[model samples]
Target: MASAENESLDHVPLFPLNAAVLPGGRIPLQLFEPRYLDMLAGCLREQRGFVVVLLREGSDVGSQAVFYDIGTYVRIVDFQQLDNGLLGITAEGLWKVAVNRSWRAPDGLNLGDAERLPEEPEDVLPSGHSELAAVLRALLRHPVINKLDLSVDFSSAREVGWRLTELLPLDSQEKQRLLEIQDPLQRLDRLSSLLDAMD
Candidate 1:
């Protein structure tokens, strides 16, 4: 995994999905598309990663797919051949980035010039928001989330906010909005409001 200190705004391959993955989160992907398989191969050989952008328009299979400018830079952490013969990979998000330009490669892969966005500084979780951590702890008890074996710091605002954003049953647009917020506390506040509305 590339450390945040070494991240640069260099050209990278883009993986656009209907869902969003924020920094400090992990996602599973199944690769059968030749373009993505090739992209995966290159990333592994280079010891680098690709950016995951939320699709704004069009299908992920075609060249016409459009995505939001903000995205998460992720590194392949684990992989294996699935029983169905597809390649399954687990990727961990490292940080957020902003796409400056994007185009389709000859092999139909989306490539982009992206700049690394600033990460939220570590902030102590406010005492008033302790229930948010309690809520997340309950959510993590689900077998699906439990299998991820996530490492979380309940006292850190950034980790709590990002993890909650990833775990919540929020729509793609709502998740994208949380991902774009620069302040961890503000993000948590927005999440608190959203949670309230859910009830």
Candidate 2:
């Protein structure tokens, strides 16, 4: 376990994306830009994690983009050279972090001073939440989703919330709000409510 003090002191390399990755969720990135390729090499070499923040404004082509302060720190788990020679990287989100400040490097890569948020404590799943798990299982039945190998324990409250958040087609802002939530049970309840409204 990492102390809160140590966690807050850790700085992270930033990669702003139009997508959101909740804690426990995994996302695949296509790396082509020179800055990102270099960042990927360094992360792979050092076995370090990087933060993925949702792009609030600007484009991925340049470092001028504005991003949400809430982000996820992810570790690369799979990497491959794509047919077009670009780097195809798969990273699993491990920590939810709050970006205290951000700046662009001379090389065009973005970096952030971040503080890791406290993880939600373990809690038992509430009753009548089987529908949530069922929905996720149905989604897994899809060929595309099944191929991703998203291993999850539906019985776990935290996994259930995070995985559902990942599988849902909610917009980036909605997903960011869920990622910033610190309570797993409340997250689940909110998700359930959202799904109910959707229905």
**Worst ten in a row by lDDT for model 1:** 1-10
Backbone clashes in model 2, listed as residue pairs? none
lDDT of each: 0.89, 0.82
lDDT by residue (tens digit), candidate 1, 67-127: 8999999988899999999999988898899999998899899999998888689899999
For residue 164, model 2's alpha carbon misses the true position, in angstroms, by 1.4
In model 1, where do residues sit more than 4 Å from their true spots?
1-4
**Alpha carbon RMSD to native, model 2:** 2.7
Best prediction by lDDT: 1
Model 1 RMSD in Å is: 1.5
Model 2, span 1-199: residue lDDT tens? 2332444325468999888777778888899999999988877776687899988888867668988998888888898999988889998888788889888888988888888788788877777788888888998898877867888888888888888887798877788888778888888888999999898
User: 179 in model 2: Cα distance from truth in Å?
Assistant: 0.7
